[model samples]
Target: MTTDRADDRNVAVVTPWYPNPQQEWAGAFVQAMVEATAPGCDEVTVYHNEAWLMRQAPEEVEAAREAHRRLLPVALHDAPTVAGARLMRLPVPTVPDYTFAELAQQHASWLRESLGGEPIPARVVHAHVGLRGGWTALENARPDARVFVTEHASFIDKVLEQPDSRDMYEQVLDRCTGFFAVTDVLRDRLAETFPALAHKIELISNPISFEAPRPRPVTELRRWLYVGTLVERKGVGWLLEAFAECHAGDPELTLTIAGPGVLAGALAKRAAELHVDHVVTFTGEVAPDEATRLMREHDLLVHPARWETFGVSIIEAVAAGMPVLVTRCGGPERTLAGIEDAVGEMIDVEENSESIVAGYHRLRDRFPDGLDLAKGRRVLDERFGYRTVAQAHYRHWFSGPEAGEGAASGGEEA
Candidate 1:
């Protein structure tokens, strides 16, 4: 499938977070998608979330500026420009951030101004998430500009957790052009709420860069690793409980957790209560290299997330040829299908000691000597590898609107 329109088609890829050297998996897939899609098109440009820009340190900020300079083709826009191929970063004010509603409104105004007098000839405006950047795209992109939104996780879920933001979420969803849920579970839930856009929805799993599986030497002590935000939804509490049960029987077992969130103190307390604090290590947030090193060293990767749209870490572990024990939540279940034996096991999200112990026993029984790293690696390469997924996306991109219609058929309710 090809488009003569391809040469004229200018795409603006927008995201709220982007991975840097300091924070590896923080929107790392966005970086991969832009790099992959940009080269194939006549022009591809990227826009960053200015709200997040304020949180970085001076050096990190400078590093991001330099990265954009080297990688992206266009510049940040004071106002939108009319060009055949251009990447324009929408300038958002650093203050008066009252709420998500306010922020979206501010962004909508900025997007309108960015386009200025120029008509947006954009065939597609691909947004990384549905709420923030996606809302802005829906608001300002030319009516004909198809808006595609990828829901990485439940930003709405996060908002609903706070008593103040529930109404604001409804507004955000209403403005989305088409929704992309990372997992079937998320898609179903969204479909229940917005049946009108249900047919417009699609399932797009996050992609991983497949590497030749490097098997690590069988470690003397079986190490387990968990990487993600140290938050409630990640099921850190459940993981701690499960780890405690598993470690009680096997005193030599060790666990390492990476990433930062507000639940750090609560998780620490839970660990102490379970009396597994001695064996558990929390590294807060670490560099990507360090996270990968820990994954390689570990015998199994445990992700007891209560809810996940897609667990990129599970894919990363599979790519690294390590087994993963994930909850039968959103993302992990989708990724673990078919390759259940070699990669890892999925436990119930109950986060009980029995469930955790059972999950461990399941892993031990399936690969009593430990998983075949080679087999695990092969699974990831065939299914989740970036090149394969990228090709799928490229087909979707140039194939035009009807492609999405066919892809949307037989779509399960999530």
Candidate 2:
């Protein structure tokens, strides 16, 4: 199962988003994966999708500039220190109202010039997300070059909203040599959509590097921390309502929401309307280190997401020795299942005021002592640590059958 001179093998990690100083969660996983695979890899090149060039909005331009500034330090950090890891910034603007075929053509051209013309050939292309990066990876790799795709979320829901990307999902699947899903729920859905590619789909959870355990005692005034984008899909509005209800009886209860998104203004208004604005504090988009620091101050981590590919936040919380309250719609539920202390009591995804209130009450009654941070941290170290998860991925993507179990193969149409 071991490849001789593994450090000599080259891999190109492709993604649309990467973390900058502002702490974007784009290629964070890819960065973690490369570090884990370093022992068995010679070099890892990160190719980012610079589709922001297509954005003409003044606001988007400002955001892009900020993102670039934040990313510059990490980009430079990766350049020299990390062995076998390189960052390649490719700015490929989206075509104006262009179809996937047209977008693919533009991406292919970018790859031909940026990657295809490189002095050294890449043995494998690993893409995060399904459509754009995956399409570009397939186009850039040699015919027999290994292509691995990790489905982080449901792009079909996002892209198929437009008529042009109607068949984009299938096209991307057809080109991938193997597909990786963050949750079994997503894998099953993908299997149904493209049965022909079902066999190639493998369920893999997000890898989290375990942090130092921080154990806090359960107290009367429970501190609940919600970290993620303050958007509708994250169920922040409902969470606020529930918190208001909880605060009515227990005024000591406080909810700290970290992260920024389009719905920030609405969420703030909703908190005021619910009269819980005093109890809820918004610390817009903190860095990972700061987020972890905030997590340490809280007793519980509540993730009321409507949909998620994998809840890296949950894993991060568990690693920090915190209990989680996640909705049953996405990847976090599965990660919770692996931990005995956090199983069976997931929040309902319906995520209305009633459901949120009910979930809060249920948790309050069940674990008044708060979740067992030690047990949760143990679970994270055993199942989702970056080293173990990355090794699993390396076996699945690079070494073939001899590495271990081969991911399911073949495609099934939905």
Candidate 3:
């Protein structure tokens, strides 16, 4: 990265969750945007506030606080580099279930920490997610600098349910320069709930580019794959029953459930009870790179997620040209609408066992020889690849007054 191209196009990206050594996969896509845009823009400063304390048990809070006290960066030398971007960890705010005002105050302190009493030279302060990060950007962004937010939280449904959070979120939207959404479904959902801010909302989906490292082999197992956590909401239990339904049709078929969660033991037990234990393999929490490789190595991706804002794994598989089976979990339908069915498929999330089993049968019957995944890679890259999305984001960042021209007015589900 020559500083020449980015002369003064400094951007400060703030997020409440980011990937760290302890939580390797947390908010990784946000880091991807930071790295890709850094070369095109002058400089990128990431102020990441890891709020893992909220997930800790009540008795473990003090111990977890001590661990973070040892980890949070208070100076630039101690700042870490992730995916070619400089990252500084800010102290986490108080849990918002109790109070939103205190959360905003903590974020105000974090913005001051970024400046060290100096004026920020950022051309734009972009925040990912809502509330605290959004509040920080809204308060500290230079008057001339732009304030943009890219929201990806699934908890927006709950946020809307609360009077205080909903009102605060509306205030956050009203004051910001622009808002970005990952999926059209979410963009529509936001527009529906906050009609006043609907015109300010825009669509800029997440980035994904697959580079095959090795020649992936075609195995004879006729495998069915699931890449998300083994959680109840993810419907991994439904996946087991669905796979069991498919297993009876083809004895040669096998299932691989990657990624770990609290339901791992129960899922394994259910597989045994289905008498398909010998056919099911449990891979606890595969890393992103390894997960990408697994997508190519396997015959198909069976995603039975009950809920998703946007399914990254689906694009990953489709980008690799692998066949996919997804459920209508808010975003999958919109995602698959762009891809060819020979390369992917979807089922009704409500009728999981029957629909997924039928979906598998459809994959087997239709793609008897499996899909030519590499065939669709070029098109997928042109649309959702990192470089393309980053360039689009860069244009929006620097567009200034012209930015809101194409912003969605009716919040069309585009």
Candidate 4:
């Protein structure tokens, strides 16, 4: 994957969020995008600018910084290469008090220092997340490089709340050669914040693979699965309660909660208190491939999320031939647009268990006869399959005579 000559067609990916030992699900979408687009490029390298938060006593702050300075020199090449792309994880250590703009600046500083203050070698750079990766890439990429940014942050509202961060975000949009959002929800949010730059943001989907369908379309909906962080905002608490109610009615029912989060311990304890711990399995932080495997092993995807920018997991579940019982959260509403009934049931977002319970019942009642899993799969694959998204990237990244300079004419599909 290494080459002596830096081809003008080489691509560099920069991002603050990436799958790591501490958080395996952190940036799986970015990884998927890289995996999709790498084959067409002469070279691809991922610079995972991991912003590691530091909590230290005031007296030991300087010592912690010194330790980080020593550790970072050797840590750059420690990440495992993914999808034939060379991986470099540059850990940017910082105190917890920095604002979003400041944190982004810190990532840029670490990236610059790691590269010995040199520009990224690639002529084209694709960055995930508008603030951290986008800003960092803009600051560190070669002057002639065309930097494209994709916005997928769930807490974009919070980021825009701070004036400094919002101003910096505007600069990112203004400077980047192209900008995309994974869903209309995120695109509209950014557009609303900066009405003048609305024309710059366009819709692009995260790629999903449908090469391996489930062994068989699920005949029954007894096996329930939830793949996401176990946190209140994700509606995991409500999922547990709803699962308990469902299990009580059907003793054979089972639930598997995958991925890690702050509420893991509490959720397990609550499951025990509900007396359904026997059937509940908590798989903490599975790798992306394992998460896909889990989708195949189960019959249903129960995503009780309060919000999502794109709902990649839901789309993945459908790709794996599993019916989804998801909420009408921001992203799912758009992602599952016309194919809602064919794929699964969509419940209104709520804090209690009632909506999920009702949705599950509705999905079970519809089962095999009332759904067209094949049709749903076909529609989603046409929009988000690896080949489709990869080609879109190529058209945008290498369209013009100079390559990556034809951002204005990039595909404008919704």
| TM-score of every prediction relative to native | 0.76, 0.82, 0.84, 0.94
The TM-score leader among the candidates is 4
The candidate with the higher lDDT, 1 or 2, is 2
Candidate 3: residue 345 lDDT (0-100): 66
lDDT value for model 3: 0.72
The models' CA-based lDDT, in order, is 0.66, 0.69, 0.72, 0.88
Q: Can you write out model 4's per-residue Cα lDDT over 228-314, one digit (the tens) per residue?
A: 887778999999999999998999999999988999999999999999999999999999999999999998999989988888999
TM-score winner between candidates 1 and 2: 2
Better of 1 and 3 by lDDT: 3
TM-score of decoy 4: 0.94
Backbone-clash count (model 3): 4
Ranking by lDDT: 4, 3, 2, 1
How do these models rank on TM-score, best leading? Answer: 4, 3, 2, 1
Candidate 3 C-alpha lDDT tens digits along 19-56 = 67666667767877776677665567888865533666
